[model samples]
Target: MRYLMFRLAHISDPHLGPLPEATAWQLANKRIFGYVNWRRNRKGVLTTDTLDNLITDMQEQHPDHLAVTGDLVNLALPAEIANAKRWLTTLGSPEDVSVIPGNHDAYVPNARMKAEEAWRPFMSGDIAHSGPLTFPYLRVREKVAIIGVNSARATLPLLATGYFRKSQAKKLAKLLDECKEKGLFRVVMIHHPPLKRSTHWHKRLIGGSRFRKTLAKHGAELVLHGHTHLLTKDSTEGPNGRIPVICVPSASQGFGNSHKPAARFNLFDIDGEAGNWSCRLIERGYSSEDKLISELGNQMLSIPNG
Candidate 1:
């Protein structure tokens, strides 16, 4: 069978709207800052309307798979988590979509566990043998091997950091080698950018150096992430070549506020066999000039390390 190109749509940080009502207890912790931030600044910027428009445009493109990087909810409230479940179904079936968590999804000490319980299906691997789903999970789609890594963890007030555990790095190395031996294109998904200098001090990916060390040793075709809420294109060193590391803008960002780009999603067209694959990135999102969502641009991505 001649395998055709696999089109994967990537979006992140929806920060889904109309945060659930919270009592004093719920807002007493770090959530208070997030809550205040949401009410004062984010309420106007992160809108479901923008997210709906972006998703509508993305669905119209007919991607073979969808990858959501994280932050589906703000404050990680039970109601917010439940609402995210409903919003996810509207995106596609669990089988058609793969998701990871972001810092906001783990806004509290117990929030990450709650998110895991709620968004289990979207975070599961291909083979279902599990008591608890683990990170660096594997999902195969035709010629591609999707590796979902967990870097999300609750942080102190005013910090939006993520952590990549050493254990996950070891497992990720093994998975990379296994996928390489199988002749599958490896795509690693995480909530924060793997590059060390990708974000500010407060929002950097903790253990990013270790994450890059693993990729340098084993190599991968592509890396997708979302946290800085900016449209970014950068590369990290791989064993044989450079691996493309990409991050998209928030899926629900409006036009006026913030220095970040307006809401956008990318469609990556991946093709070719293991050693000689090709990929292209087509970006579509809102334009601040006219506040209209349209095809922003496209670029041919670098191939995987040999």
Candidate 2:
């Protein structure tokens, strides 16, 4: 049997904006907070020119697939959702892209429903079965399986937490098992980190414990997420071994202090067999001073041939 190398470009938290035109009624709710933040501080930290440069750079790399872990829209406004859909078209065809929603994508209770409808093509599985979109959506790209989980949900004002529903949790384990049997490189992508302490208290994933349990039970090659908006590396247990969970900074983060790094994305060059994988991670980010996007970090991750 021959193994082929697969390159996946992972990006998160684009939070695309300029806050599309919306009615006052739309801004009367939770969106008000998001809109105010966007106008006051976020707008400065996140610039369209910076984001465009980052995307252009990623396109230059031309990975086999692009896995975006959500927050395409900040307020989940109807217009914002529409804007994100158009943005998705630019990312690539549904077959070349997979996406999951973030807390901002479901800023309001009903906003999640609207988001599902708008991003259905990108989140739906290859099998194509369903009236409504469902989580643990597995997109098989040749030698890789990109499984997207929906951690985005509506919450009270000031809360940015995500939730992995009991139902989604159950399906996630089974999805991992199926992927394992196929011997494909499984990359679990979500908006929130599945590990505890990976985020602020108010922004953590609600069912992280259960999510962790599922992963330890079934296992996956790698996990990618983006809710924290910073580059972080950590790991948790897996059935056969340890699973690497990486979080990259906002793809639109222009520049900032230690807390806020500039726009960045993760590129994984993967190959080899189960338990003996040779994966090279290249962390790429924008350089405002140089007006270019360049490699920021690199690591050789090997799954010891145990």
Candidate 3:
């Protein structure tokens, strides 16, 4: 029997653009601050051209699935959300892409809801879900079980925090167990890092302890997130052992400064079976010298046997 490896591509914080025109009412709340910040700080840095090039290269790799961790829009404006749907479609079909909401997607009250309505196809599970979409949704592909948890929510000005409720914790625990029972490679995707102290206090995941507790109890093969817009590799306690948590830079960032890095994405090759699984992570992004995307490095991720 031939063992076919699954190629999964991970990209986050695209912040997809050409910021649509917004009315005064749309900018009245937290969006006002985001609008100003985008205009002054991010407008020049995050560009669709950069994302296009990066995605073009990613498509050349012919990944089996794509995981978008979020921040597909800048202001969460209606037009921006609609455009993001089109962008996702151009990137891949709904069956091949899975998305979770980011803080920016919920920049203001009900903004995340709008995103849900527009991007439901990409975010929904394989099974039919009644009413509104729920977090910790499950999508099993081949031998991999992809679980999506939404941590994004509307916040006050200057706040980019994420939240993981007890409700989600319960559902996630159940999902993790179900996946494990099936002998599947469980991969959890969340917008915010679940590891404590992984991000600053103001921009941290509020219920990270609860999230971590759930993982510690239930266990998972890997966790993927994107919010810091910087490459990060961290791990947390799991029932079996330390579970690897990974993050990538903003997918739309055109160039890197001393502080913020350039656009990048990860390609994960998942293979093996229960109790003896294997995964290799390949980092690909802009080469500062030529200002072109290329393979940066690769590593074999530690997979704790459950």
Candidate 4:
């Protein structure tokens, strides 16, 4: 029997707006200032045109599933979330896409406590909470399993910390075990990195070390995240094998700087019977008329790690 295969497009940290005035001011004073310096030195470019090009390219690729890791909004405002929902709708049906919340998504003081109430309309599966952690939820497909977790919550400005909560971690273990028994290719998604080194001190996932341990035990095939706004990759040795953790760059990085203008997204293809997988990075550029264009990069990875 020839098992089914699927193509998945992974993108993260779009940071849509309704950007708050305070945040906008910070970006202008700090990020924009740096951006101007870089541009003056002919180092980078910042523009929304990159995002437009990315969207157009993704539409053409037409992956079987789209996984948006997080930070769809800059300020966690209702208007911003609504705008993000509209963007997702334009991509495809809600069923074809899966999303999770980032720290910015939980703008209100108790946003984590009320995530389901605030963002349930955009999500497509059961999301009832079990204690403080509501996760290990499943998005089942004919060829793969998408497991999502909630790692975003309001934090003190000084701390800027994120947590998965103990209950959620334990639930994730059980979900992974079950999925493994069923022989499903599991793709775990979260806004925060499961490994500590993937983030810095102030912005780290508070329980990341423990989360990594859980994933190592359960054996996730691929782990996807955002939050750092830069392209990065790491791997962890797990009971089943080595699991690749891929971090995507910010889609809006071009907004403040023109020098570092390479904005990109990822495309993944998985074949079940052959146990083969391929991924490529697609970047956005512009034409002389200022129209957006996509430039495809070399294959990032081919699975079975030959």
Stretches of model 2 off by over 4 angstroms after superposition: 256-258, 288-291, 304-306
Of the candidates numbered 1 and 4, which has the greater TM-score value?
1
| Model 2 poorest ten-residue lDDT run | 297-306
| CA lDDT for candidate 3 | 0.92
Model 3 lDDT tens row, 168-284:
999999999999999999999999988878888899999999999999999999999999998999898999999999999999887635587889999999998889889999999
In model 4, which range of ten residues has the least summed lDDT? 29-38
In candidate 3, which residue ranges exceed 4 Å CA deviation? none
Prediction 1 global C-alpha lDDT: 0.92
What is the per-residue lDDT of model 2 for residues 91-121, given as tens digits with 9 covering 90 to 100?
Answer: 8999998989899989998888898898899
Candidate 1: the clashing residue pairs are none
* lDDT of every predicted structure (CA atoms): 0.92, 0.86, 0.92, 0.66
Per-residue lDDT over 228-302 for candidate 4, one digit per residue giving the tens place of the 0 to 100 score: 876677876677567778887766566444333355677666665424444444443333234455554545553
In model 3, pairs of residues that clash are none
